[model samples]
Target: MYLFRLAMASLANRRFTALLTVFAIALSVCLLLAVERVRTEARASFASTISGTDLIVGARSGSINLLLYSVFRIGNATNNIRWDSFEHFAHSPRVKWAIPMSLGDSHRGYRVMGTSAAYFEHYHYGRGQALQLAQGRAFASDPFEVVLGAEVADALKYRLGEQIVLAHGVATVSLVKHDDKPFTVVGILQRTGTPVDRTLHISLGGMQALHIDWKAGMPAQGAGRISAEQTRSMDLTPQAITAFMLGLNSKIATFTVQREINEFRGEPLLAILPGVALQELWSLMGTAEKALFVVSLFVVITGLIGMLTAILTSLNERRREMAILRSVGARPWHIASLLVLEAFALAFSGVLLGTLLLYAGIAGAQGYVQANYGLYLPLALPSRYEWTLLGAILAAALLMGCVPAWRAYRQSLADGLSIRL
Candidate 1:
């Protein structure tokens, strides 16, 4: 205990060098913990992107593919499910709500989603949080009105009542545009740190109206023009939708509904539980995650090695000081314990500072992170695994302490006091 105080006092005497060693360890610990925290939060945010839905029904395809396109907006669907099929299940007595989704349109590179007002009412993200309007109201019966996601609205500088045209296809640089069918920004959604924040929402009718004049993906020449007023009267019912999310009144019926959707005679379809599909998706990415973690672990190891080197090098210079303690009745084991205590002090300080640094970085950059990657990294204490890692580092530091401590133990009473040229 006295040796611990003496060791800290000794380090304070060489504060400059001590601080440099601590700095190296601190940065390494910071990076290690940062990677772990981000990785964990990313997994959580990714899985939570769309929850409170028992199953995501889409045209028959791999669950991973369906999740990628429907939830992540990463790719296109193989085929669309008929609106009639969607409606049939949507009206099931067991169903609490359903939000039909139609894709294949883009606005300024952001994906445009066609859905009903039920989306604003039933869709949930990040633990069942309902979609909230940040600026204006949700799109109502108006076929030409649009709702912008927070990121989409902010990135494009769109305001309520701003008019924007959607490209014919999902391509960001589509050559064909719906110049005649511009949509008004009726609402802007609160940031959810999900794909929704980058999407453009519109009524399913709006999607149908946008292409009412096009035939086979091209504007039909000599075709009867359908103005917005005319579109109001025309059938806006969606022919086919990319996917639909369903919330059941009773979760016990999840399997029953999913089975019914899969066995439907109307069309080939697949029903995937979000939690199960997410786990399957993670299996594909698990290797890469482990690789990143291993790399961070090595960085922490290298930093500890550097701290070890600094302590060992400083031991020789402190031999004379050690001899002074010997003269003051300090035992050989006391010198050893003193050396060990200093290493422990440095490691503990570094770990403490590193943990703080991680939270500070997350607090400062989480907004940018969410806006860019749509992943929310919450500010929180070190997780169980992170605490385990810190414990390992301290254990390593204590072990590394023994190396220099042993060398100090070998110093003779007369040898440490005598100087050799």
Candidate 2:
């Protein structure tokens, strides 16, 4: 007990150095926990984005690329699936419903997705959950009505009845705008923490109406832009769509239906299972993930190295203190134990403090993240891997503490009653 008091007093004496060491360890702990949280949440978000949808059909391309473009909105599709292909798949006996997606436009930075009301009816995420509107209503009767994702509404500060113009193509700045045919925001969706939160939903006819006067990727030479009121007279039919999400009548016949769609002679298309495509994507990205983990490990090692150097540098000053304790009848083993205990206590406090900081950040940013990205930042209990990693960190700290403690023990024995500097 006396030796413990001596160790505590010793640490309290050099408050500045101890605080610095604690902070370094805390920062390393923060990095490790943050990386673990991000990696887990990223996989969770990806998995939840396409849940309950059995298959996705798109133009002929790599399954991973098609999934990345259609599901993640990360890339562009190479080709468009013809309208006839969508109809064929929709009417097939095995298919319950199909949601055709037309991309290539944006309102500000938000993506404009043209689809029917069927999208809000069938889309699911995060444990087979369905879409729910948070405010206003769906585009039931109004062709020009639009629905805003939580992110789009929050980021742009748009509300019901606000009118906005869609830009030509997906460029950040567009020379051509559909200012002539603006759409009204009639609905706002709840936060889902998926790409859906970042999307602008409009009717298929609205998309067609916007591009009516354009041909060959530009306005027709002799065509004058039509007014919003005059658009009612023009034919608004979509000729192509980027991709389609398919719901099957039965999960058992999913492969048979997929085969039918893939072998369809009416149009060229490919059907990919969302789970399989996501697996392929992760596999392709595995090298980068592994590299990141390796980097985090190196950071931890560098921190531990810093910790050791700090302890060794401070040992000289502590030697006189140790000699005083020895003169007061404290054993050499007791002195070594004090050094080890100090190291262990600093490491434990650092880890605990770091975890609290991480949770606080996640708690504060939870709403913003869900509203903007549709990712639910839950502050649940620590995962199994987190516990395991924490245990490993504690064990490593103990090992680091032992090195200095052992050296101090040897020196106390050699010096006996004499003081060594």
lDDT of 1 by residue, 1-421 (tens): 6777788899999999889888888888999998888788878878779878888999998999999998998899999999889989999999999989999999878899999999998888878898999998988888999999998888788899889998978776989888888899889999888899999999999999988877776776655767777788998887889999999999999999999999999999999998899899998888898898899889888888888899899877887999999999988899889988999999999998888888899899987887667777888778899889999999999999999999999998788788685
Please give each candidate's TM-score. Answer: 0.87, 0.92
Error of 2 at 217 (Å): 0.6
Please report, in order, the local distance difference test score of every candidate based on alpha carbons: 0.88, 0.82
User: Top TM-score: which candidate number?
Assistant: 2
Clashing residue pairs, backbone N/CA/C < 3 A, model 1: none
Candidate 2 per-residue lDDT, tens place, 217-244, comes to 8865435776667776667778888999
Q: Report clashes for each candidate as comma-separated counts.
A: 0, 2
Evaluated at residue 333, the lDDT of candidate 1 is 91
lDDT of 2: 0.82
